[model samples]
Target: MITDIRLRSQQLVNPAFNDPKELVAWMGALQGQEYSMAKWAVGLRLKKPDIRKVEAALEKGEILRTHVLRPTWHLVVAEDIRWMLKLSVRRVKLAYDSYWKNHGISEELHIKSLDVIVRALEGNRYLTRQEIGEELSRAGVIVGDDLVGYFLGRAEVDSIICNGVDKGNKRTYALLDERVPPMKELHKEEALAKLAIKYFRSHSPASLQDFIWWSGLSITEAKQAVGLIDAELIKERIGETDWLIHHSCARNVRAKRVIHLLPSYDEYLISYKDRSMALAPEYYRKAFNTFGIFYPVILHNGKIVGNWNKSAKQKQFGVESSFFIPGIEVDEGELDKAKERFRVFNKGGND
Candidate 1:
């Protein structure tokens, strides 16, 4: 029942969004470190999944990929980025403090690097990481691959720069102000409430701990956030656990036989600290590795049934599946439909 609610909440079943931008805004943010797979993650949630449409949203600046929520890359809507960053930047920086110190990125150096980066990207020019690193070197700032990555990430969290249109397959950075128009800024309290509402509205039947994990808020702050939105959410106790479901999602969602080829780090599994609702404990190791890497998964009726991999051969795209339970009964019609949906999302060729 929880999984059914999650399926509807996550838009994996009975998807209600027609536009990719609307969908991203609805989900708050999607894990997007894996560029290609993250596109499919958005596509799979559409009423009509279209990879081109998702990419268009990113290119047109309707949605932006940046470091937020946690220290990892997430795709957030352009309008929400400012307030979201303001709410989470300090926590994100705290998480990365040690790395910065170890890399000799003192406050002065951080300021200097941001200044150089802002100058380099001020004129609507998009620079790849290599190009940005070269600019830093030209400015007499010591630069390396790792240091460049840190500098760019720092710039992103500071709202100094953001993702620009890709150069072929390479990612580029653009001035955040240039890429996105000015938007209203929310105060800290308003931002926290908004974030809590967004997370629960899109990921309901989640616990306070799940919210804390996904939002990167400390336990005290996370609890305060939930309290700010307590009246709007419905608490349901399942066994010994208390789960919070948004009022809008507090209804029975009929379960159906649906197959989903969820990408690695999809919110369905990753957003929550405990994944037992969708992933069985016995199969945890198979779905995730020791290093916190989640593999692409096959979900049948809201439960992870197997794992899958994508392949391309001479422009032809294919999906290979490995079932956890051999000889498991599956509806061939549904499975074929799921694979066909993926093929269409892949544009019938390797991307």
Candidate 2:
């Protein structure tokens, strides 16, 4: 008796899906959560929720702690980032090396950049983007305007950036050695296998292509990894592909009416390629950024029906911002549920 793995993953983990921090913390790198306390929930494509809830989460220590993966300012859990980075550092290096080569940065210069960043940022408390750029400029090198950003990204990929202290719209980096508490080392192979298993266990019913995208691995490596775990996983044909999932997933998928107003750079959209299950291709450009980044989306019946974001006065906390209905007919159930979720997100004021 086969069943749906997506429902199973949710049940095994977030049955109610209430604690976003828990799932996000495990994945290691969710971009919007990286830089801002709260990203514009661009999932539905409209900017919603200013800055009230984000502050509240931070105050509650429920969100906005230190962590890194994907070599970016990912706002993942403090506890999970260590393991997530352990799993993804090699991939980050691959991205860094490829991007560096494309940019024509010499290996020697790369080493020098690392040295300069190490010295400049070490022991420094917090720094703004402009400050980082200035420091790089003083090191007798010109990376133009995006100098600091590119190099800092490089550092992050190299497992050097450990912390991103928020300073208004800007962020400062901390040495990985300083910010993150020590963790046991993981073998490269172990990390690869563990992450592959984790993603499958959490987000099942996915193809190899989906795994490749989520893991940031080349198609070849993705295939190899899948081969390693294929025997242990259960596969079922959905459309043209055999989606892999754990045995326990997808047991009871009774059209659970869930309206989730997720943040920008949330995992659901980015987790798979065949998103038609939740969204239509025509709305891709509409619901996502110019870069194919999915915006904050409204999910009804386990699918994206619209997009949204919020405007914050000081951009300090998350809020229960108002909603605007489109010309299309809206489901009363989904609509009310969305409003209730938004109210939960915004607690009447900032922290």
Best by lDDT: 1
> Candidate 1, residues 218-286: lDDT per residue as tens digits?
898898899999999999899878999999884776767789899998999999998898988889988
* TM value for model 2: 0.75
- Residue ranges of candidate 1 with Cα displaced over 4 Å: 348-351
The sequence of per-residue lDDT tens digits that candidate 2 reaches over residues 222-310 is 77767777766887785677878755455445544456666666666666767766567776765676766556666555656676555
What clash pairs does model 1 have? Answer: none
How close is every model to the real structure, measured as TM-score?
0.96, 0.75
lDDT to native, each model = 0.89, 0.58
All candidates: CA RMSD in angstroms? 1.8, 5.5
